[model samples]
Target: MKKYSLFQFCLGFILILGCVTWGTAFQNREAFRIGEITVSPGEMKSGYLDVPEKGGIGSRIPFTVINGAKQGKTLALVAGIHAFEYPPILSLYKIKKMIDPAELSGTLILVHIANLHAFQKRIIYYNPYDWKNLNRVFPGDPEGSISERIAHVLKKEVIERSDYLIDLHCGDGNEALIPYLYWMVTGNEKLDQTTKKMALAFGIKHIIIDKSRTKDLSQSKYLGNTSVLLSTPAITTESGYLGRTDQKAVLRNVKGIMNVMKLFQMIEGNPQFTEEPVWIDHYEVVRSDHDGLFFPLTEMGYYAAKGEKIGYVTDYFGEVVQEFYAPFSGMILYIVNTPPANKGEPVYEIGRVKEK
Candidate 1:
């Protein structure tokens, strides 16, 4: 072989060095960013993602990032989509305190409160500024109402950045609900399987085999639904109810999150999967036909027969306006336990159990 000159040899070495640098860039442990905060490996940071004021109403989302030392999947835990849901909200704060980045494998983004406006005002279901349900608008409009703007920011900053997501919720102040999770199907077998695995790993016994959510991207509506349509595996979990922040409710939320982190391999320990899962094959959220007071005749987790009177709504003057009944035999997933029931609002939900 002919020997190369010093200049040619130097040029060859420089090219090889450049190629090596470029190849390693893809494997670099880059910092995680949200809003103005940046977190490097083995660090945890918390801050607010400012939502610009529009239409005289604006809100801020409180988030935390626990970035791990080792490379792994990023899992997002979101709570307080409905302000009155106490258990899920309380759980996030506890999680933020417990998880140490030095011991973690990947990042954990905790959206402590997605709707601070509603949360501060103690409002349930709807935002105080726009009266729009924050959960009803996903992939939201930047120039729309305050709730919409909040949703838009979350879609861009939180959901889009996460590899897996968990939308934690509980019964609103008015709603008495049982612990359960939605296993939303996107019709993509692999993706559906991934979501199903997440639900099982969440440790909730009641799992809704729900394929009823919208496939239309424009109206993906729910937070978890938006993530699913965007190709991110997500599950919506419901635990506590009636706005009570009991210790049992709080710990249940905490346990579920911990188990899911294990499932993603972002933390140590095996995921404690549900030993026996109750599959809800079909379900319906029976809506009220009149603005009135609702009296539930059945509690959550109990079975009701077809055409059984599950609840009744009475007018403002205490006159019976409408009586609600079970469409078919199933378990009562949730019901409006409080008196105020609006026309076209959900009164109670029933889930038909699937045969094993």
Candidate 2:
């Protein structure tokens, strides 16, 4: 009788341990996350999906969407919207691993690499047919080519589904861009205020609040009145150039995105402010007048006075071909540091000060 009692006690203890283990496992299940999972622009039901186009061998597009524990605004983080841009996608990958969905109070959609076809082929975009730039084709066509179809689905499914958006990018091949964040101004007073606030929140220096003259309905403008008023504030990060990815720039961008999240109160933490960001509105593009071997005396982001010699162009024989000068008192926001230059090509972008 004593032996039977001991055996029963041991069995009871084992059962309790098993229940605790199972309970813990159930609590940790990833699906318990409040985030909804939907494959955009296609029916990709799992991570690392191979999307097949009509003509080419399909490419693999990997993505993950993590929602917060409590219901809140959905913020979409997308990279490789332009395929050749590597840093943003890498940053997205890092951001994905760092987030704990259980602690989130808002939805975070991460599209690490959007243009698989362009990425696989080492192309800047998926427009081999009409030679259209992919960035220009937003809110894409539903009944169009492969790129258009993909864009269409993205616009309808993802872009329309989010409260805020961030399109990450790097310089295309054959060009380099100084790290900067672009904020498009719609001339709307409220939006402009919100834009400035969001820009500061993101901690992006070298901000260009562009009041572009083009009236064509772009994705940013068109998406303003939908869910979240289709008026979601958007920003893009331009860092590094050509097929190269810089680790430092990537870190800067990652921190920048995190800063924005903190600003919006999506993340529970103190805001990281390493430096006071610089704000600039006037930008003047310096174009080359003739083809030559280009040589820059000064680097990008250097302040220069009006008519100051910034760089000089030379022929293959080392003879001075052309001398580039600052058009106004401003800082060289973006300079073509490449050794070669051609006529009518932009060499530097001078940020001139506007009289207040």
Best by lDDT: 1
Q: After superposition, how far is residue 201 of candidate 2 from its true place, in Å?
A: 1.5
Over 1-356, each residue of candidate 2 has an lDDT whose tens digit, in order, gives 34568888999999999999877754443332212444222112225433445565334456677756544566777788677778887888778777766666566777777777677768764455444455656555655566655565566656776768777776655455667766667666786666566666666666776665244544532222221234676666677676677787677668877777776677788776536666667777788887887777777678898989988888778899789888888877667766778777777777764444
Maximum-TM-score candidate: 1
What TM-score would candidate 1 get against the native?
0.92
| Cα lDDT over the full model 1 | 0.91
**TM-scores for candidates 1 onward, in order:** 0.92, 0.72
Which regions of candidate 2 are displaced past 4 Å?
Answer: 1-61, 124-130, 144-147, 213-215, 218-229, 272-275, 286-297, 308-325, 339-346, 353-356
Per-candidate clashes, comma-separated = 0, 8
Error of 1 at 118 (Å): 0.7
